[model samples]
Target: MSAPKPIRSIVIVGGGTAGWMAAAALSRLVRTGVSVTLVESDAIATIGVGEATIPPIRNFNGLLGIDENDFLSKTQGTIKLGIDFIDWTREGHRYTHPFGEFGFDIEGVKFHHYWRKLYAEGKASWIEDYNLCATAQKLGRYTTPVADPASVLSRLTYAYQFDASLYAAYLRAYAEARGVVRTEGKVVDVLLRSEDGHVDAIALEGDRRITGELFIDCTGFRGLLIKGALKTGFESWKHWLQCDRAWAVPSANPGREITPYTRSTARRAGWQWRIPLQHRVGNGYVYCSDDISDDEAAATLMANLDGEPLRDPMLIRFEAGRRKLAWNRNVVALGLASGFVEPLESTSIHMIQTGVSKLMALLPDRDFSPVERDEYNRQTQIQMEQVRDFVILHYHANERTDGDLWRRVREMDIPETLQRKIDLFRNRGRFFRYDDELFADSSWIAVLLGQNVMPAGWDSLADAVDPALVRQRLDRIREVFRRAAEAMPRHEDWLARNCPAPTASVTRKTA
Candidate 1:
């Protein structure tokens, strides 16, 4: 006996980054004879605010056979080495959470342990000063990692800041060129089968009924297919993650030294993000609407801009949570429809990419197995929860005393998993990654120490290495990072020379 083949007709609703990403990846990876159609309305606009990204985006681009320079040029992209958090810990404090490791560990013990011992004795400096990525980012430098494993530059990792609409448009063309059929219309109706209550097809405004064996819901926050039709429950994380609204707007670049890092500056009520792109800078404030009015939040954002405002900031409301099941019956939700965890770390696009990749991994058959669906939902839950905990750490672990928002966040109870990690780090300066979590050990250590969460004791292994040798190793690493950063080119110069956005003559119009 052989397993039954999955359905051939796949329909994706909506055409932003999520929809086009799903269509493009499916068209490129799925077997031949399978039809992929995406329907989106011209009147429907996407939230184009998520411009900054982490390093995993490179893997997603690589999966689609995308040329790095071509994609960067098409999207008016610029390099982002990591994020610089200002005023999060306390007033007059700043820190850089770089992408790569800070320093090398010896005998399998983390390097933070040795650094803790030095700091306790008042002999060491900031941990981030030893990170190549952090140093390069702070200096407005950009360069791909060197090939030599022995070089400190080899450990540097980076992502990008680009126009989200342009990225979607880029992927749209890529998918269309690869045989994806795109339908233009608003999804007015979703038809479900009576026998199993699974989504069977969707009807457009003109009564044009399109049928498909499997449906992908990329309908933004509406969740038209997954929650609207299938009634998948949502797990509200408001208690843990409380910022429920955001205001985004673009501004003219300040023409200041353009560093290769995103800036997240803490405000009285929320945090304001400054993301530098080649064309313009992206800025926004994420705050709990209850603590601050929309007008107040907008004003706070406008008042904090590095440059003059280019447009009236747009407000986006959201819930902090995830769908109980990302994949339900014959429908799988992607992007905002699936759930939102806020863009604190710019994980919105990455989450969409991960959702699509998971669907592809569990590519189902016509007879959707409970086994496969359960596994997909289970994994999705774990990943989202892990990310949720990480995001919560920024808020809960803070030492800010600015206002009600900061006081509340600082006192709120956090998830046990995050608490455990914090306790472990504070106790022994030790950190461990479980189940291949997204944020690595270096990230945890950077954020933790940056916020003044110092460990009480050093790792036992640090005792084995001579204290003088540890100091020498630390000094050597810092010098290597400084030299490497000095050798890199300016971020703006690199983008302009390597990947310039397409002109009107060569650009594709969004149909």
Candidate 2:
């Protein structure tokens, strides 16, 4: 047997958040004499509506040695504790899917179990009352989580809301500074090797060619190399997801206190997202073209802005699914080229981050072993399916009677994986996390209860804890969270003091 040769060069195609993120992360390889090059055309536009993220983004930035405050200021970013879902369960109802856990577990059992028993006895409040992040978000407050495990504030977790284009630009600077070469040209053709059909080179306009041992496709939905040349197919989940179009626009800041959370309002045909940044608010209406026309979707978005529109609504079209194989032969696809599952839960940017992390973990040699590629694809598939099921839950579990879209989704069948979780929770508020699932037990509990999916019974284990003790502990947790939220600075004030953007013109408003 011969020793495997190490990969010498990596070529990344495209330059939005995905391309730049891959380039930035892989730039570390330059230290080992491996060349990393990214090709993107200045003329190409990116689908930059992925302005919201989950908490894992903090880890990604930390890995890159980025200062949180500096990155926030540069990207006109604002903290996001969670999402406020409006009218998803039914009209005139609202709930929050907070980032952190609910009250601490009692006697090694989940907190929700005890809360359920208390609620049944009319002695408990909403689940959000016991969560620090949700309480702070409701009060328009902001604070970093404390490191001490004994502190109640230590339970808080958060992500960020920012201008996606600015974030990509920030990452581009970071990658370039780390010696990643950026080429400004559109790939016209993908040349392949005759013997193995592996990507050999990419030909840009004016006959420029760039070659690499490994190729990464970040070419958005076109999949220029992964699909266009390699013929890797996509697995569509439109039957379950349904929403296929969106109209995204930016709006001027309303000069109100910037809430430290994202808001998702349920519309007739789809949903509307409102993400607050330091400089402006990013707004969008994601809808199914079959249920609503583009003009109607755009009109709905325009009519609902908190401030004047900053630009004409840009239309985006997409289906919900993943590539059949994220890694195929010598090429790996990230971002839209890899797959898209809508941005309902703000998972788009996180998906890219996960892809970059996985590629780095399973990076192949010049020989391109099938073992490495298979493991990468397997993990990618599981993650994508998990996300798909989670997103579908938002739609499938809705109780709104105003629109056909909601009614249809509610009656439609969901994946067994999600159905199993729903069944388990509905039975006794029992929930379990799957292998490396992105959403934790807290997230599942939040959304499930938020949508009015009440369990038929309380956990038998929770019955072991005395009712009086449960009530006392729950009340104390609520009071502590309330006081902590009150003591924190207002979100807008915190931004002004810690990381105000140069373009920000914030106006304080009483919360």
Candidate 3:
């Protein structure tokens, strides 16, 4: 056997949030001598669908050395404390899935269990009151968490809602400033190596051919390099997630206070997202095509906008699944090329960030060892399935009988993993995190309770605490959180003072 060859050239196909994210990560993380090249054409458009993100995004940006304030200003970003799920359990029903932990653990017991005891007696305040992020978000407040362990502000975790397109531009500039090379062209054909059946080079429209030791496909749902060229297969998860298409549009803010959280309102056949940014609101209706027509979906989105429409609704087609092998041979797929779990929890960009981080962790030589690829695929599969389950929980645990779409999801069988989770939660509110899955126990509890999936029994250990003490602590905690939120600066006021974007560069468009 010959000696292993180190990867010298890295080629990334497509350019968008995913492509640029990979570029930025590789350019910064990859050591010297390994060149990173991104090939894309100006004619291609990315889905740019996910505007809101989860809390983990802070780590991703921190890795990129991005200043939070600058990123917010440049990307027209606003704080996202959590997601307000409206009409999901039923019409007019609402709940907030926040980023931070709930009431602090008292004497080594979960707070929710004690709350459950009170909740059953109709004495506990809404579960949202125990969470700093949710409480503050409800009060239109915004503040970054502090490092001090004693301060309530320490628990105020959050994410961001930003312009996806602008984020890509910002990352492009960052990646270029590093060492990633940007190639402007469209891939017309692919050349393969005979021995290994790996992509050898890609022919551009203008007779330019670029070759590399490895390829990263960020070609969105088309999977231009992974599936189109390498013939990698895909796994459809439509049965679990029926929302295969989305219609997106931006709207003016209409002079209302910018809320520091995303709102997902359940529509007749699907759900619509309202994400507030510094300049405009990003709204999208993600519906199952089989249940709703494109025209009706578009109309529903238009009629529900909080402000005047700024652009024609852009339709995006997708399948809720992933590639059978994210790293097939020498090709690795990212973004929609890998798979989509929708934006219900604002995970689109976070998935991309994770993909990049995993790839870097398993960086391989030119030989592209199967061990590395297999590990990458295994990790990716686990993370995707975990996220899929979380998103599925939102759809599968619905109480709404008003729509066929909800009925189908409600009655349909889910993965055994998710089933077991629901069962455990239903038993005594016991839910465990496996392999460091992205969603925490608090998140599960939030959704479970929000959708009215109550526990038949609270943890018996919760009974150890004196009933009077539990009540006293719960009331004190709730009141403290409420008063703290009431005192913080408003979301809009916070942005104006710190990270406000330059006055809308383009005139606000109206329908």
The most accurate candidate by TM-score is 2
Backbone clash tally (model 3): 0
Residue-pair clashes per candidate, as listed? 1, 0, 0
TM-score of every prediction relative to native: 0.97, 0.99, 0.97
As a TM-score, model 2 comes out at 0.99
Better of 1 and 2 by lDDT: 2
Name the candidate that leads on lDDT.
Answer: 2
lDDT-sorted candidate list, best first: 2, 3, 1
lDDT of 2 at 399: 79
- The list of candidate 1 runs beyond 4 A from truth reads 29-31, 502-511
What is candidate 1's TM-score against the reference?
0.97
Error of 2 at 233 (Å): 0.9
Better-scoring candidate (TM-score), 2 or 3: 2
Report lDDT per candidate: 0.86, 0.93, 0.90
Candidate 1 structure quality by residue, lDDT tens digits, 316-368: 99999999999999998999998999898889999988888889888889999
